[model samples]
Target: MNQTSTECVRVDINVFPTAPPPPPPVVGPIPEKLLKIMRKYKYNWRLDQLSKPKHLEKKFIAEVVEPLKIVKVKLPKLDPEKEYYADQQSIPLIRWLVINKKLYGKQNGKKYRKTINRYINKGWGSIYNFYKKRERDRRLRQRKREAKKEKRMPDFERFTKLAIPKRLFKPQSPTKKSPAKIFSNFDRLDVLATPKPFVEEPVKRLGVNPAALTYEPTETVIRLAQIPARLKNLPKPLEPGKVQKSALRYKVTPRIETLAVPKQRNEKAKVDEDYDPWTIPPNVLKYKATPRILELAKPTERS
Candidate 1:
């Protein structure tokens, strides 16, 4: 009533205040006795020297310390044939083709996909993951090599192999084999695909002997003479001579594996003795370093 027109002032209030964080929780002070004991022991406190260290328990050593101990475990031998990657350098098929002037002088996404797919059957998986795993393996190998190098004698030759030349990795042209040709399409027409008999054959049911279906026992226990007719289909007993001598059969011949083909397989045989068709093909590299007699007539000797 004194002001007749009283002005109302609106004040903006903040729900959350932005301020520096409160100090961290105060840790309880170390016991004066514990502090004195720690000071006496010093930083280099030898637990083993202690008569009865509280932390050094038998259970602690067995359960915790033993497992925590560092061990140099021997790695299993890796087979190059099994562990070897075809594309270790991680070169993309199209990229390789381009570099080598292959791919029929074409550069496109479709061609790239097709080229990549060609090597997929040969165990090419996700390129990204493959390279990642390869890098990880390479790092581990490097670490092992470094450790070995440190421990090795100065006079002894280190296992430092000569680096492979980039030219050696020249991508060989993919063989002129097509997927369509590899997997020939053909419908299976075999009627005996399933166990179901043909229209002409009788429907066979699996159960007790077929003879039992028609059997009609004349008495509670049939005479032993009738046993022969009842057990006609039963297997015959072994004869004295035909009986097995030992648990393991001696006549069995273990498989003899021939690793390499015959060296002189392709050599011309006498006219009387024709070449064996089933013989393994000759190795061209068998006489790689050795010189052979010339079959062609010499220029000087020829009339």
Candidate 2:
């Protein structure tokens, strides 16, 4: 028996519907009308329009409506339920706010929320407590080190008190000498010796001639007369000059004529041929002139 074959065709439909084209591209929280108002107003837009409530409605419209009418291009979408954390950018902003109070409200509210969340995660109370404990421990450690240093120092007064008593009170006193033994021998010698009685002899006068012995004068008495009267006196008179006429006559003569004969000219004395006064330099003859010659050569006319 020949049977006719019928081919079956399989149609595969994607169960997820291609994820609905990623729910269109999330356009913006800022709408066209809001953007126009923002452009007109510059930075003075209403806070409620820029807030979370308006952003949620705008996000829904962008997620649902924008891509369906277009070429169905998928773009990145932000989750409405999850928080957008900008902690990296917000930390410097928070630090700036803490340093400058004027920037406290001027910062973006979202950035402030992210910074507050980060600080909460890092535990602000724990950081403050750690610094406080560190300072306290440092002070305690410093005090303990100072106490130890003081304990190591010597107490000079206590050392002095212990030393003085040991040095002053250790030795015994020396024994005294016996006075009775030293004086016993001296007493016996004084009792044994007796003093002799003094004897009296008669003094007699003998007669002698007065001329039997001749008196002699001492040599020292004769030398007394030889001493000069001027030497005995404290001061003496000056003597008058006794001039010798012969000596005065001798000194008045020229020294060369009185003391020596004149030197005679010999055959060896020669006349100098070069002794021309005009040829001689004036400076060479300065010491050769007599005083009388110098006076005679003076100018007759006064200047």
Candidate 3:
């Protein structure tokens, strides 16, 4: 049996592969939503990855940076959960990349990363230099904007010149007026009589002498005097949105009554009124049994 053989023929066509749709123009103004996110994070680009060049190339280094702390933020828009724990001190760029990944996938995330990189690579050498220069440029831009706005505004002078009256311009003759009238009754006359000298006189009083009079404070006055002390002990108002700490509660214990006994003393023995403890022998002093030491030592040994 003869086997039929088939050979495939190669054909060449002049057709060229189309280029990708320009990568969606990465070099353009960042989205307002992204800028809002940056503002929330205070435009903090100080990240571990941003600090080192080796970390820049690593795709997963900036994936999940450890935050300074985790805080629960309230989100009213979400249906089920009212609040969610969010990372603090996290890089805004990383958050954008994450959001893009979840919403648009890896390609969009890469584009966002490139945009952030472009912004970061603006100034001379490092991220710090870039941020400094960016801040200076922003200040300069704000100043220029203010200057332009002032230039556009109409000149509103606070004190404007008033029009001179036509009557004042015309020459007028000076007129003479009669002298002011002087009344003899209105004249200030010097007092010819001098004031009488002060004289001491006997004061008449009803039975009680003025020197013996005393003042007694009323109940209201006493209460007013205690107001300052009462105010010091008053409970302070609780801070807004803060729970006041509960006051400590002490447990009450029953009091045990004990029979009182008279202290014992030897009357016959010649008691030394001047027994110098400092001059006593060292051995005796060291082993001396005092009431306080005996009382304290009672709890040491178990019966």
Best candidate according to TM-score: 3
Q: Give one digit per residue, the lDDT tens place, for model 2 in 1-303.
A: 336866778999877633222223336696788678656764442443356363344343544545445467787776653323433333343344454434553565767756655654443234334576577679999999999987999788888988785445768789787676445586667767756678886666466645655656589878875867777775444335865556578655587676678545444443655444346666877868889999999977522
Clash list (residue pairs), candidate 1 = none
TM-score of 1: 0.12
Give the best candidate by lDDT: 2
lDDT measured at residue 19 in model 1 versus the true structure, 0 to 100: 50
Sort order, TM-score high to low = 3, 2, 1
Ranking by lDDT: 2, 3, 1
State the local distance difference test value for candidate 1: 0.57
Each prediction's whole-model lDDT (CA)? 0.57, 0.59, 0.58
Residue 184 CA displacement from its true place in model 2, Å: 60
Q: Give the TM-score comparing model 2 with the true structure, all chains together.
A: 0.12
* Pairs clashing within candidate 2: none
Better of 1 and 3 by TM-score: 3
* Cα lDDT for residue 294, candidate 3: 89
TM-score-best of 1 and 2? 2
lDDT of candidate 3 over 1-303, digit per residue (tens): 336876778999898886433323237789998667666764334532365675446355556767788788996565433222122122344445446556665555776667656544432333335576678789999999999998898556632333444455667789889899977753335443556689998777668876657767789989877858756887666565775445345433443222334334455333867654447567876797889988988855322
List pairs with backbone clashes in candidate 3: none
